[model samples]
Target: MKSILTKPSSRIYGATRQAPGSKSISNRILLLSSLTPTKTQLKDLLNSEDTNIMINATYAFGARVQRSQPEWSIHKLTLLTSKHSELFLGNSGTSARSLSAMLSCYQGNYFLYGLQRIHERPLQDMLFSLRTIGTNIKHLFRPSCLPLFIRPLATVKDSIRVLLDGSTSSQYITALLMVLPMYKRKLGKGITLLIHSIVTSKPYVTMTLLLLERLGMIVHRYGWKLFSTCIIANRYTGPSFCIEMDISSASYYLILGLVNRSNLKLLSICLYNVQGDFFLVCILKRMGCSILVSRSDVSIYKQARKLLPLRIACHSIPDVSMVLLIVTLITACSISLSGIRSWRLKETDRLLAMTMELRKLGVVVECGIDFISAYSLPTSHLNKDSTININTYGDHRIAMCFAVISSQGVNVRIMNHQCINKTFPSFYYVFNSLAG
Candidate 1:
């Protein structure tokens, strides 16, 4: 699991096994549990690197959590003493933002820091919204970014509304909602927050709403763009919330089923999900893959297609870009993907990394300041290098994305094989197991 991958000269010829609970869902549920005042139990929560870091950070931030067997219990914080405590956010952005927003709403002096790159990442938009609402947050470096110092606002008058930039991260909006519930429930007055923007990655916001509703709270969404709701402070008994298997994580395997032309049976695939990433199924169908969605599962198989010149706007489904990008690579076809501009701010500079890494395979990629378009031609260049060593850039998506390149039978070496730990720690094994 730790070695650099060496791609074979022939087809990787295999099937794929899937990972469990979505990391995105895991982080959101963790935040929900922390905000809920009563004991809420979480079931099927991801125990992966990122979610685990979130779990530890949650307890560190003063949320009492207990894990036993298949259920985990959470006791919310009445008062998270915020006195100059330096909180390490690790590499989990959801944990960092959601937790930071929570701490800001609480009365305290807290220094917010994260994994080195996380501190380097910007949080200004969210920070400014928090500060505007009168929470204590200071940027040691810039105005709207991370490496923040949050000093408690003693006289912050309990309620405020702010705007969120849709082009940026939806996490900012999610962070606002996460804090809004608490301020409404515990603090003096309930806040009515109105967010106006062309929201992207609209599924994530849906995930937040869905989880909140499951916790027995109410919230409203106007289409996928506007969210307005009041979370009444209630005695929450954290009932067992089963985490959904990651559809995004299953994408690579779905692609494998098509690419390998294998005879593996598809079972229990979730297609009708409020999770926005489910659109991946539509995108695949467009590309001429044979996919059937049954009541029990979804199956994807290969077919002959007039592979269109795909110009996809991926801003709504950032996490699935890896598989899409690789699919473009296989077709030797031209693909222009947009709406993914914010992908630059992901765990890695996704735009630049995707372009540079694909170029190593002798494919031509042209990336604009905000978009990336690539085209590969039919060529006999599979074994020119015999082994392609690609850097993961510390982003898990990049690592898994390139793993597909090996399907063509080219020995691809991944610089940091462990990066997949962010969402799917057992990705390599699960993938290779299909080879058996």
Candidate 2:
């Protein structure tokens, strides 16, 4: 259903709600489970399009997957036995990139394709790295983009090494990291990776490594330049695993409390979580939002005065930048955000998307290669219409961030509102519950 959210006449009081499991953790665990030769049970698995694709991809590789709400059972494939298969990943970069690397290291003939937007996303760095390790994979359409075909390698290499461009998506590195363990199991030697430049989204790579350690794998990092993994048990041993609540999804509600000056609580979300987006709370506090952290939940209460404008770099917290930008818009303050070069590679070109959309609301936004400065306009000059339409460009964050604007009493009509189903299917429901 299309959502046209209008601000409530009454103030939003304090409310508590639970977010879905972290998509990042759910997908990573799904990939790791497929490489094992035992039955694994995953609890609190995210039931979204992105993660469903990962589950189906694992099933195609001959693993058995069964779901019973909040829990899933995966039976490992005895061998990389799928001789031929076709996978259609719908705009899930995590599933496409990670599954491609896993399929390459196995004995199979596979075709990996995705939605048009996914094909536009870059995969060259990961593909090049896999090719260096002797995987017989080729890009069917563009050099770095998708529509890939993989043929079985005649012989698996004993060890692998490749240089990656770190400026692009960190998923490339994650894909490589997830697949290397398989090589170790087959050839009895580990793999080495050299990153040629400064890695953007370093926190995501750290998250990947932390998950690997939990599954009983060891990865060594020498500064940001190189990563090497030694042979451990190549397979993940799991009777059960639980995923954390999505910190990225929780940021929206936290911002709501900050903007409305009402008390907001996020259920089952912890402040000391592995998810990098958890740092958003610190950024919020720095901007003069009152926050309280406890063992059970995190709460944000609105401030009496206008929020302090911020000038910060957001390379590690890229996902939260859009929400922060929206904060700048509502308060009409000059905010400068830098270290966001990777925004261009997301589901849409977010920098361009934000600038174009904000201009429609009479906000002066300047975009650079790695920075954005938003100069707030006076309320008199701003469009005072009760209703405004926003184009979402099929990016979930764009859709959700703008939805928060509606809570301030403006009517916001979000075009392509279904894009939020990719990660947070219940976004609108949860948003309404809080705003009411």
Candidate 3:
């Protein structure tokens, strides 16, 4: 599918929107809910390919899942019953890593795999940590990638020590944290995790701990390198909860308001939300956007002042880097983005993809191992063609970021526009509605 966004009108009024539920929070809550024995009522759940993969994986693990639009009722089993199962998680890294950790504690024969891209994603760090805890898991094809065969222990050891390579993905650490509480329950002792390198996406790990703490789980951290969690409670008392709107999704509209000098309000969002992408608001504010935060809403309006060039360390908030790069493009300001080496391991090589795509629009981008420097270029240097076709490489972020270029009255045709279904299926609809 190809999506064409005509240059929108300069001024947008009376634009108020709410994004879908946070995909990160939704999937984390889904996995946590499946560990409980009672029924969990989750409201404002994200209905997307990634979250759906998590839901299906939960069901495949013998949990009962029922959904009704923005709500879902999950009845979890005391223990997973399917001893022999094969799970195809598509390209969801969260599902593959989280479920791999959960399945490692059960006494069963399980196989986990995904699409070609998923196989290319890193899993060795997670697999190696699980192995330290006596999980009988092996890579079926390659050394570090997926198609893993898992045989969990019939009885867990007294204490397990895990040494993780923190440079790759924080999801590996979160996967262990999510399942370790159960392991602690079975062993009557806590699990210790040691980080051998500086962890990326640390805010994501913090979000995981926050959710676990909300569910009455105990987590202890020593500096940024070490973490330990013990099981204080064996059974989870399932509770009814509502998820916040996705801040990452809200970012596009934020950018829309900033560049277009329009007023925009995002409903069902809070200033104290757990998402690391919430930092985007502060970034925009620093870039000279006027933002107001209320209890349940955030309003952004364009400022008359110039947007100052920024040098930001985005290790904890890598997901927003794509949109931020677009921000630099529209502002025609030199910006330095650092601490994003893990961007290479995402749905695509985002660094490379962004560099390639931005050059097509006559932007100068220099990419390093873990940094990106975007030099200011006049929009006049853009291709003289009526429309620029952007290849998305099946990455949802790539599709969404280029779509923002349309706000500058530059027509963009995003190839593989359907990739947005992975997270925000209504992205274009929302964009069109607000762009008017």
Off by over 4 Å in 1: 1-3, 6-16, 64-84, 222-226, 263-268, 378-380
Candidate 3 has an lDDT of: 0.85
Q: What range of 10 consecutive residues in model 2 has the weakest lDDT sum?
A: 1-10
State candidate 1's TM-score. Answer: 0.91
| Model 1 lDDT tens row, 332-427 | 767778888787888988889988998887778888877788878643556645677888889888888788767666677898788788888888
Quote the lDDT for 24 in model 3: 94
TM-score of each: 0.91, 0.95, 0.95
CA lDDT of each prediction against the hidden true structure? 0.71, 0.82, 0.85
Question: How many clashing pairs per prediction, in order?
Answer: 14, 1, 0
Query: Please, what are the lDDT tens digits per residue for candidate 3 over residues 1-436?
Result: 6665544444566588999999999999998988788889999999999998888888755687798876889997647757788888988888989988988888788899999889999788888888778788888888868888888684456667889998788899899889888778777776899999989888899999988987878789898788898555667767887998999988888888888767889999888788888999998889889999999999998799988998999989999867888877777977899999888998999899999998888778999999998975755556545788898988998999988887766778888899899999999888877666
Clashing pairs in 3: none
Best by TM-score: 3
Clashes of 1: 14
Error of 2 at 199 (Å): 1.3
Candidate 2 Cα lDDT to native: 0.82
Candidate 3 wrongly placed segments (more than 4 Å): 1-11, 154-158, 380-385
Ranking by lDDT: 3, 2, 1
Better of 2 and 3 by TM-score: 3
